[model samples]
Target: MTLNLENEQNHELPSDCEETARQVIRQVLASENCPYEAEVNLTFVDNDEIHRLNREFRQIDRATDVLSFPMTDWESPANYSCLEDDETAAGSFNPETGELLLGDIVISVERANEQAKEYGHSLKREISFLIAHSMLHLLGYDHMVPEEAAVMEQKQEAILQALGITRDPEVRS
Candidate 1:
């Protein structure tokens, strides 16, 4: 997997944030049984930037912790079989690198800090949770409905637990 990460915010994230994101992405893809190499773009921005993005894209006035923009529409969440059947599958892969272009994720570092404090967890855990949540979105998962939200939440918690980045104060990453 290849991750293109950029930080536009002044907020200081954990020094190992990139590695944490990569780990979460890998875990999500592996759990989903994705057969192809993948690529993802992740960006860190301040509350103002994310608020603008939310208003522009989602039409929500509030600044969100994270937002995902997926590149493809899937018949089923995390199912790669549709890609094999679609003639446009070639468009989803990078021409030179041959990695599937997953999608983009934008995170608000300011919001993450606030959420971390509110949840009584480390910043690393909060960021990791956001990455995991957004990765699932990139793979076509959503939490708009209660059932879907439960599944997404379960998967996210499982991924974090597997990485040893849990909500418990005893566990730290």
Candidate 2:
């Protein structure tokens, strides 16, 4: 697995954020039993940048915590194709690693920090959850429907738990 992380925001993010995100991505991929070597590009942006993206890509004029742009057609959790090798395709596989370029994950650092305080958890935990959630999205998970949301939530919680990231007690009860 190769993770390409970029901080496009001016926020003072944790120095270890990139490593944390990589670990979360690995855990999510392993839980899904993904067979192919994978590569992901993650970008950290501020609310304004993410808001612009949400408007342009989703036609929603609001900032979102995270957005995922997947590069594959997912047939199932276990079966999916990296973008076609044709140059006409949107993205290509990495020649050096032979890893499928999974796609990009954009996160709003401003929103994440606010959420961490609102939810009474560490910033690290919140960012880890966001990365896991975005990875699932890249791997064909959607939570638009109740059933799908339930499953996605379960998978996210499981991944976080496996990483020893749990809700702060004050936030829980």
Best by TM-score: 1
- Cα RMSD of all models vs. native, in order, equals 1.3, 3.2
Clashing pairs for predicted structure model 2, backbone only: none
Model 1's C-alpha root-mean-square deviation from the true structure amounts to: 1.3
In model 1, the number of clashes is 0
**Model 2 regions lying over 4 Å from their true place:** 81-92, 169-173
Report the CA-based lDDT of candidate 2 relative to the real structure: 0.85
lDDT of 1 at 4: 98
Per-residue error (Å), model 1, residue 2: 0.7
Per-model TM against the reference:
0.96, 0.89
Off by over 4 Å in 1: 170-173
Task: Kindly report which residue pairs in candidate 1 clash with one another.
Answer: none
- Which candidate's lDDT is highest? 1
Q: Model 1: per-residue lDDT, tens digit, 56-79?
A: 999999999999999878788998
Clashing residue pair totals per candidate (backbone < 3 A): 0, 0
